[model samples]
Target chain A: AQSVAQPEDQVNVAEGNPLTVKCTYSVSGNPYLFWYVQYPNRGLQFLLKYITGDNLVKGSYGFEAEFNKSQTSFHLKKPSALVSDSALYFCAVRDIYRGSTLGRLYFGRGTQLTVWP
Target chain B: DVKVTQSSRYLVKRTGEKVFLECVQDMDHENMFWYRQDPGLGLRLIYFSYDVKMKEKGDIPEGYSVSREKKERFSLILESASTNQTSMYLCASSPPGYNSYEQYFGPGTRLTVT
Candidate 1:
């Protein structure tokens, strides 16, 4: 079975400062990781994904994530946080070997990110 | 822009009543999914359909059912609405064969069971 863990329930950061939200996963085969952000009363928006090849992946809204194989982690990062960046963040993972149709993702509990001015 | 639209943004229903949540995507994607979002639980998949009339049970499918009569439409059904089933429901669609293809989401429908 595949699973994801977000160690932090909430993260606070000053605007213009770098922000990091930690995520870790456990899977039997190669992992397909994804990050999504959700605003209050809205649906989740895709941030980025890590399939293969690159360890560092850049995403929309000046966000990025680093995939660490040994650590079994994929932490979301933003060099300069904005106050509007405050939202709920989710980390998800799936087993690539299980085939595409079976691409059911295991998601984390979610991290509430609050960017202060 | 590709649009995924849910039929309602908010709904209130009585317990034991039958409810239906509809979703439509204009991108003609091959895969559509239904998920319920609760505080601290993130999104839990209820069901998904890869093709018309073909559906599969997701991680959490109890008390919920789905319909896919057309490629662009997917509907979630609650046979008997319960208070515990009240939550924000999200619909998503994705293309086939693309391992990295991202899932596009609808605005979501918040359902309240009395």
Candidate 2:
């Protein structure tokens, strides 16, 4: 079974400060990781994904995540936080070797980020 | 750009009533999925179809059914709406292949069962 966990329910940061949302996962085989953002009353928007590449992958809205295989973690990061960046963040994981699963992703409960201006 | 659209942004239905939620994707994706989102549970997959007339149950598929008559459209049906069925329903699509992992999502429909 593939599963994702977001340890923090909420993260608060000041404007211009760096922000980080933590995520970790468990899978039977190699994992395909993803991050998505959801604003108020809106659907989720893809932020980035880590299939097989460098440890760090850049994504939209000046966000990036580092894939740490040893830690089984993929944490979202931004150099500077913005008030508009406040939203709910979700981490998802899929086992690439599980063809029987049909590309299904297991998602975390979500983390609510608040950036103060 | 991939665009996934849902039929309704908000809907209210009564208990024991049959409900239909529609979704359409314009990117000609081979896989379509239906999921229900809750405040603390994130998203749970309900059903998915890999091709026309082919559907598979996901993590949660009880009391729900799906239809995919065409390549671009998928519909979710609630056999009998119940209060516990009220939640934000989301639809997603992705192309078939091992390399294609990200799934594009619709804006979502907020369904209320009274």
Candidate 3:
């Protein structure tokens, strides 16, 4: 089974400060990690993903995530937080179920991020 | 731009009534998925279709079914709407092969079963 975990239910950060939403995962094989953000009453937007590349992956809206294989973690990061950055964040792992050709994803419980101005 | 649109943004249905949630993607993606989003539960997949007339059950498929008669459209059906079936449903589509790593999502449909 492939699963991702967002340890923090809520994270608060002041504007202009660096912010991180922690995520850890457990997978049977090499992990394909992804980050998505969802605003109220909206669908999730893809932020970034880590497949087979550098440790750090940059994404939309000045966001990035570091993939650490040893720690089994893929934490979303931003150098500066903005009030508009407040949303629910989710970390997911790509999963190809046995006997299935379609690729699916398993997401975390989600982390609510509040960027205070 | 890859656009995935749902039939409705909000719906209210009575218990025992049948419900249909439609999704269409302009990207011609080979894989389309249906997921129900609840508070604290994240997103649970209900079903997915990788090709026309071919469907696969997902992590949570009880009380729900899917249809894929065409390549660009997928539909989720609730046999009998229940109060517990009320949720925000999301639709997503992804290209095949290597690009399948990422999925494009619809704005979502909020369904209320009373």
Top-TM-score candidate index: 3
lDDT of 3 at B94: 94
Candidate 3 clashing pairs, residues 3+ apart or interchain: none
Q: Tens-digit lDDT track for model 2 on B1-114?
A: 789999999999999999999999999998899999998899999999988999988889999999999999999999999999999999999888777798899999999999
Query: What's the lDDT for residue B15 in model 1?
Result: 100
Question: Model 1, B90: alpha-carbon shift in Å?
Answer: 0.5
lDDT order of candidates, top first = 3, 2, 1
Better of 1 and 2 by TM-score: 2
Overall lDDT per candidate, in order of appearance? 0.91, 0.93, 0.94
- Residue-level lDDT of model 1, residues A15-90, one tens digit each, is 9999999999998878889999999988889999998998999999999999999999999999999999999999
Error of 2 at B112 (Å): 0.4
Best by lDDT: 3
Instruction: Report fnat for all candidates as fractions from 0 to 1.
Output: 0.54, 0.52, 0.67
Off by over 4 Å in 2: A96-101
Candidate 1 TM-score, true structure as reference = 0.96
Sort order, TM-score high to low: 3, 2, 1
Instruction: Kindly list the per-residue Cα lDDT of model 3 for residues A17-81, writing each as its tens digit.
Output: 99999999999888999999999999999999999889999999999999998999999999999
Give the lowest summed-lDDT range of ten residues in model 1 chain A.
A95-104
> Model 1 - which docking category?
medium
lDDT of 1 by residue, B15-111 (tens): 9999999999999898899999998888898998888998988889999999999999999999999999999999999887646358889999999
